[model samples]
Target: MYELKIALRQILSRKKQTLFAILAVALAVAVITVMMAMLSGFQDELVRSSIENNPHIVISPQDEGEEFIHLYRYTSALIAKKEGVIAVSPKYLGQAALEYRDNAEGVSLQGVNPESEENVMRVNKDVIEGDLLTLVHTKYGILLGDRLAENLEVHIGDLSLIHISEPTRLRRISY
Candidate 1:
């Protein structure tokens, strides 16, 4: 068409300006490509870390009114029977205050069946002092995270007082 020829002539006439515009578009596209790659890389790394650090599947209560222990007991069996599950461990999680002689910090307390816990989560190897499996049947025995232990200024055998929030009231348990 005559219009196509005229447009081509116009672009050819302003060579420097056309080149600059093309370069700008190329630079913008390159930036967008790099940003997209970085975002995808970040997402992949996050998913990999989560998969490596946590369980493949977590079976939790579906409703707020159900007790966590009830959910754990029921789900443990169901998980054990599931096709892809290698092992199952009952989990009990509660919020408590970690206390030492003078220092205290509120922490999330988790009770796990250690013999089967290895199948679910990779235990941190740098834990300095306590046996991870020692709390299997030990009621009132609490395992503290490294940071939490440091905050409370306590060692493994040292006692800690825990204050928990119940449905209707607060209760204190010494560990």
Candidate 2:
């Protein structure tokens, strides 16, 4: 009790020192609080962006030389039957060039069944223009990346010729 009284007396004697000490502590707490809020917000944004942009799992051909997955329909069906599997989408990738009017741009082409893709990827959510259902009736239809479409000067409903050259096959698609 005697020591506590002395300490209190000492603190009260130095009024300016006590004020500065309290201010410093309060400022530190305020700064820390603001920093924590900012860091939490940044972390949430990063997680949301990752979830929105990336797939939960990606299955690729085991052999690097293999261009296509064999019996993809059977594989997709098998995967869909597995526990915790919600949907499956089989895709084929190739390199192609899109030509529209005078503009031409090389693009990586991805072919996917509209129904399966919608079930797995929810592609309709990301579409900015035109319905994904358009591909169902349109033979040899394609969806281009935004940058590729911009480079080729093409828009929805516009016709673009796609030339795909592979070691085994060469094909052209018009849409």
Candidate 3:
């Protein structure tokens, strides 16, 4: 008690120094509080954006060197039967080149069952130009990204050629 009293007396006697010290501590606390709030807001936004853009879970082939998932239909059906599964859309991804007139651009092609993809991704909500339901009836229908469509100078009814190369063979398909 005596030591604390002596310390208090010293601080009280140096009024200007004590006031400056108090202000410095207050400024540090305010800056730290503001930085913490900003960090929390940033983290929350990052998590929300990641959740919105990605699937809850992704299932891929277990083998590190495997290029494709074998028996994907059976696997997908089994996964769908598990608890808490709302939908399953199996996709086959390939690299292809799109050719329209003289323009050619390489792109990644994804083959998906349109109805199943719609159930899983709600893709129809983002369709701006054509009916996604057309894919159900159109035997050779394809959906392209806006940037790809723009780059290829293609419109709704225009035909485009796709060339795909595989290890065993190369195939060209027109749509």
lDDT of 2: 0.78
The residue ranges of model 2 lying beyond 4 angstroms of the native Cα positions read 1-32, 166-175
lDDT of 2 by residue, 55-126 (tens): 688888989999888999998889899999988889888887778779878778788888878887777777
Whole-model lDDT values for every prediction: 0.70, 0.78, 0.79
On TM-score, the leading prediction is 2
Clashes by residue pair, model 3: none
- For candidate 1, the clash count comes to 0
Candidates sorted by lDDT, best first: 3, 2, 1
Off by over 4 Å in 1: 1-47, 69-71, 124-126, 166-175
Q: Mind giving the per-residue lDDT tens digits that candidate 1 earns over 1-175?
A: 9999999999999999999999999999999999999999999999998887777666667788765746566667876897877877677777766566788787876767767875567563534676655666566566666776677667667665666774322222212
Pairwise lDDT winner, candidates 1 and 2: 2
Error of 1 at 79 (Å): 2.2
TM-score pick, better of 2 and 3: 2
Error of 1 at 111 (Å): 2.0
TM-score per model over all chains: 0.61, 0.72, 0.66
